[model samples]
Target: MSDATAPQPFNKEIPTDEEGKFRGYAKARADFLHVRLVVAACGALIIYIPHSWHFALITVIAVCLAEALDTISLNQSIKRLNSGAPLRPELRFSLYTAAFQALLFSGVVIGGAILQPRVTIDMFLICYLFAAVMNAGMLLYFNSAATYLRLLIYGITMILIISMRWMYFAGAPVLAYETAATLLLAYIAFRVIDFVENNFREQEQDKVNALSRQKSMKTQLEVYANKERHLLQLAAVAKHANDSVIVFDKTGRITWVNDAFTEITEYPRDEAIGRRAGTILNGPMTSPETVAKIEHAAATHSPLRIEIQYYTKSGDPIWVETNLVPLPSSPEMDGGMIAIERNITNSKLRQSELANAMRNAERSERAKSEFLATTSHEIRTPMNSIVGLTDLLSEHDLDPAAREYVVALQDSAQSLVRIVNDILDLSKLEAGKLKITPSVFEPGHFFNKLDNLMRPRAEAKGLSLSIDLPDDLPLLYADEGRIRQILVNLIDNAIKFTRSGGVTVAVQGARIANTCRFSVDVTDSGIGISESGMRRLFGYYAQAEDTTSQKYGGTGLGLAISRHLAREMGGDLTAVSHEGQGSCFSLFLPIACTDQSLEGIEEVTQIPEAPTANLAERTILVAEDNATNRMLMSKFLEKCGAEIVFAEDGQQAVDLFCAKQPDLILMDMQMPIFDGVEATSRIRALDAPQPYIVALTANAQKDDRDRCLKSGMDDFLTKPVRKVELLDTIYKVLADRPMMEKPLS
Candidate 1:
């Protein structure tokens, strides 16, 4: 470590006390460097005259080198302290080096005395040693290790010098006295070094204590400024907020109110300040229960949130949502409550309006259902008499002219029946009351039945009808009856429009994942729909052209109802057509498919005939209110070789059932004096042989059928009942009726 290469101060502004002390010590050493050099140089010169110059030169050079090493160590120690490194090891090393430098000076002095025996202990050497010790005590006083070690080294050297002089110069007169003065002077120098070191340490400690107090005061001032800024911001926000805010004491007397509070309640802040909150805000509309809840929360110092209706100064109703919280207690003031309220008058009005609208919609739907049911019964009752009388008239072997008129009458009646049914179905679908009953049936059997039904109509129109079915068709899971109705509509439309060419019905199906996706395409060679018609074809009461309804004579509800039913079954209905070409109406449906084999399930391809020949000797009890329907039933049953007894209403039917114990009762619902449902219930209550009861009525709504079956009727059939259907129903019941034993005549 040379003088030129030694590190200087880093010029970093370290505000801490430890760094300040280290820098001060380092500066002291640097400032006294010239003094130390001059003292050592003078000592070396004094020794030069007494001893050999070579010995003095060697000793001075060694001392200069030791001083340079000590200066380098001091600079390095300051650098380490600034970097936040521990200095215990550096301090210990510095003490060892300083002791070494002291020992070198002591050696120089002792060697000069021993080599030049003619000269005794010199005063110049004593002054030089004392100057060196004083410089070291000032420079290194901050480090106790280095300062104490320097004192110990010099004290031992002084004792050794005294002992050497006392023994070697025994013949001298006051040599002993001179040694005592030397020892006393040495003791005074050591004490002065100790006092300078102690005083310097005390001054450095006071500076450190003062720095800590200054830092603490600066921190406290910053905290106070932040608090003042926060309080100002809170005051501004409260004054401008849109929600009403108020503060009140524990006794419920208002302390303060915001601008918004005055705007919402139409009460001035000055008047509200000292009054209880409830008296100013609560009005005739405010519920006592809600006020009680607010009081309870304030009494307990708890939080509360509620919605209450209030009236303004102008007597207009307002709904408010309030949130209240208890303020923390303090020495300057008792704890208080703070509340924030928002106006919600518009929200409350909207909620009430929505409830009223829903109720009106429900009432309208119920009225529509009742109207459809009543209209169906009224229309079908007269149509039933017309249809029944026409059938009886046709069987009498009438003339050809008369027969043609009867045929036209029957076709018109059937068309009217179809129209009524379509309207009922559409209403049920629109009202969301249609129910689907799923059953497993063979696709082949279902299509075969459709073919048998539509073939006769197609042949009459001189159009060829063909059906194409897949060879590996799976058994379908769906509402078999509804699907049949949809297919019937499609095929009937096809037959009605075609003049010359054929109608082709093709069914294609595939199993994908868990569903069977199938399409039924009913294509006809009749007039096709225009492009404009396709857009509105599925809408209610719509047709392709205005003249089509007049020429074709349809209600135009079939397609709309079919599409609604298709979507309800999780499928859709669509069509493709051209104006001059034919149209293909495709019905696509997805039904649940299974891996169950269809190997041995029998298909009923032939339509069952009513076994009218086997109906002979069967006694039937007919319950009917209409005089014409009674006559028609009697005549029809008598023609079939069966005995019939008639009752005018439901109660009479029950009385006849107990007396006659007939094999079956054809019960009519909606009759006078307790309907068929009640009559059936009474008949079932009787312990007599329990004859089969069938509901035969013009009330064709689904609910009507459910009511009849629920009252213990074995079967239900709606009017105007066809001859074939009525005969078939009775034929089936007769076979089951024999199981109920009839008493012998």
Candidate 2:
């Protein structure tokens, strides 16, 4: 639909040929009708005669009727043309109607001239006819046939009026001049019409060309509109995205950037655009290699993703992960690039901090390990002397008070060693380095031995200790040492807290398939722990109460180490108790059962009171750095019936072995003039009888033991080396080797 007020611009949608011609005719007729009655009245008045009002009135009526008829014809023609009717018939009708209107107007002029034949009036009438022809030609020129037909009617009427006047009033000479002038005027009118017709044809051709151009422009506009819509959508996404988006030319000059880009760089859009990204974002700390990688990717028209350090507008350094992609070539921009970048400053900082923390943790662990090793060696050197001398003292016929003191000294020394051992065990467990070596052993015998060991402590506290073991025990495949350690810790805690009530060790076993589940309950009528205390009971160095350590004298590490050991052996330790009643600590273990019997074993329900330390006719060499330990070892070996040769350091010990070829060597690992490991290596390298070498050191870490064995030592022991342990090692070695009866020198 077209706007009624605004003229419609020419386009293909409008039928430019027939429709335009029809509209032109309609419009011209409307314009002629607006003034037709006025023109008729003025002409009648201009040629007024007495009682000639009716003539004027008739002319007006006739003009009105002609206008109404022309309008009806025009409307019908327009409808037919809109219905796709042929243009030639409508144009011919238009020519006929226009000629009729021209004839009516020419009759008015010729009638006025005949009624009032003054030469001036006649000349005025001739001029009016000429004007009317010119007006008709101007209006109807869109249809050349209509314009020419109207022009011919008015031309013939003017020439007929001129000839009639000349024949009535003037001579033949005057007639010739008038006729010639009228023909000249006709010629001019025809020339004007021809000019207008030619111009209309040119204008119509221009309108067709304009219509074609307008169609092409409309297609281009639609394409541009679609492209603009896509661009707007892309802009909206980039504007709100979290990552920075940037577009730059092949020369690395930024052409566009999104809001995120400006926010990340702390640069405004106007300042950021038209500048090289590297110039603004890259800083002194930025890696040269990373920059080179980006440059190479860009130069090769390839995509790349990299993390690089960049500086903001304020010169603060940050890290970003950038994805650089090449843009497809376009006419407006031949080769360009777009970069999507994410800020990773916080992540990078966290990585750096984590790395630093890991390095620090490793260093701390190493330091802790070294400190423990050194402290163990330093403390145990004197502890060995204390325990050994106490054992030697007990052998004498001493008074009861002296014996009590010696026993106390021995207990204190043992307690110190337990604390050191607990600390080391906890460290190993926490460091994930504790080794659990499984072995086949009789569960009955194992519990019986633990019962024997803990009974003495129970009796000393005036508390009776009892062990209830299942009669049908399986040969359990498990880490016996670790299990015994946990039980010992549990029983020790039980007896330690109990004053009057006794402690009981109850063992229940269930066998299914090849696995045996054991529940060893160490219950005691002792001071029970509160719920809060139970919560932290298995934490490192945590006890039942704050004053528990002060009152009971413990390192508070036993239960923690015990629980760790139990779990390491595929088991768990739990406890249930009520305050003021008692606590029952249960040890659960899933040990694989074996059908095979214990090899080379005796079914001793109770451990022997003592190990037979008979080393008669044996020559032993002791290498020690500490003088007290050396004296202690000498007294212990001599008391065990073995002849002792002493050395102050590793070098002297090796010399003594070369000379005497002692049957056994007690090598103090951390000694002067190279440690026991080097001394043992040197002694083992000798082309002589190899002495049984036992490593004695307080560095109780498993690595120390492995290292000692690796250095050719026959056995490894952690101090404080009990006199019994030293003598047992010597006796076992002699028994195994069947030493020759070398005299006591």
The 10 consecutive residues of candidate 1 with the worst lDDT sum are 1-10
Clash counts for all predictions: 0, 0
Off by over 4 Å in 1: 1-4, 8-243, 301-305, 323-336, 386-411, 512-514, 595-619, 639-643, 682-690, 737-745
**Taking the tens digit of each residue's C-alpha lDDT, what string does model 2 give over 1-745?**
0000112122233334655766775765654554655665565565544327877676656655655676678778888988988877887887677767667766776777677664557666676676666666665444557766766787788877886787677764666776677678768867875776666666767778887899989989999999999999888998889999999898889998888887888999999889988888888999999999998998999999999999999999989999999999888767889999999999998999999999999999999999989988888777877888888898999999998788778777777888888988878888889899987788867877787777877887789998998788788888888888888889888988887889998999999999999889999999898888888888887887888899989878899888888887888999998877889999998989988656534432223344465666678888888888877776766667777888888899888887777888878888888888899889889877677788888777889999899999988888877777666566656776867434345
Best by TM-score: 1
lDDT string for model 1 (121-216, tens) is 455455555555555555444555666677677667666666676677777877767777777776776686567655665655565676667777
lDDT of 2 at 422: 90
What TM-score does candidate 1 reach?
Answer: 0.68
- Which clashing pairs does model 1 show? none
Local error of candidate 1 at residue 203 (angstroms): 20
Per-candidate Cα RMSD to the true structure, in Å, reads: 8.5, 18.2
True lDDT of residue 308, candidate 1:
94
